[model samples]
Target: MKLSSEQIKQKLKDAGLRVTPQRHAILEAVYTLGNHPSAEQVIDFIRVRYPGIATGTVYNVLDVMVESGLVKRVKTDKDAMRYDAIMNRHHHIYCAESDRIEDYFDEELDELLQAYFRKKKLQDFKIEDIILQIKGNFNDNSE
Candidate 1:
């Protein structure tokens, strides 16, 4: 799911956001990191290449990305905010021990959830998307 610079730039344009070096770098960092990264982690990663990058700038770019649906914030039980680049409908496997997050995609699970919600038809609510963050640890033999 790695995206090229051109793809990232196109994404920005598609989101009605101006393409800038900072924005590109921030988006690239998020995608490149793959693992959900926090603002401090992103800042550290960016600093390795662009030492002049400021914390505020990274936070601002992240806000824009979140607003434009390019990235989503994932909060851990400890309330730490992490940014994820993937926007597709899916769930998460959160390792509480390590604070690690992994994307989980199951078409059947999605169908089942949708069917259950549709059947319930909760009062006057409508369904948009379902995000399940399953928390647990994974052994080396587990997958």
Candidate 2:
């Protein structure tokens, strides 16, 4: 899901954000990393090439990206904030032992949850999006 420089610039423009070198590098780092990375990790990645980028700039760009719907912030059970570039409706599978996060997409699961919540109908409450972060370890069948 890594975006090219041009694609990143186009996304910024579409989101009404002015494209800058820092934003371009930050967005590219998030998408290229694939695995959800915390702000520190993003800074480390970008610092390799753009040593002049400050920590505040990275955080600011990430905040703007989240506000503009270009990226989503994933908070783990440990309260570590990570970034995800995928904007589609999907859940996540988090492995505690390996500290890995994988995307899980199931239309059936989404429909079931929506139906159940609709039936419950909490008074005066509106449902936004459902996030199910299943945490566990993956067993290797080959072993």
For TM-score, the strongest prediction is 1
Q: lDDT tens string, model 1, 1-143?
A: 57998999999999999999899989999999989999888888888988998889999999999999999988887676899999888889998777778999889999999999978887777777789999888775244
Counting clashing residue pairs in each candidate, in order, gives 0, 0
**What TM-score does candidate 2 get on C-alpha atoms?**
0.91
Please give the range of 10 consecutive residues that has the lowest summed lDDT in model 1. 134-143
List TM-score per model, in order. Answer: 0.92, 0.91
User: Top lDDT: which candidate number?
Assistant: 2
Tens digits of lDDT, candidate 2, 1-143: 77878999999999999989999999999999888899999999999989999999999999999999999999877666899999989999988766778999999999999999988988987888889999877785232
- Model 1 clash number: 0
CA lDDT, every model vs. true structure: 0.89, 0.90
In Å, residue 55's CA in model 2 sits off its true spot by: 0.5
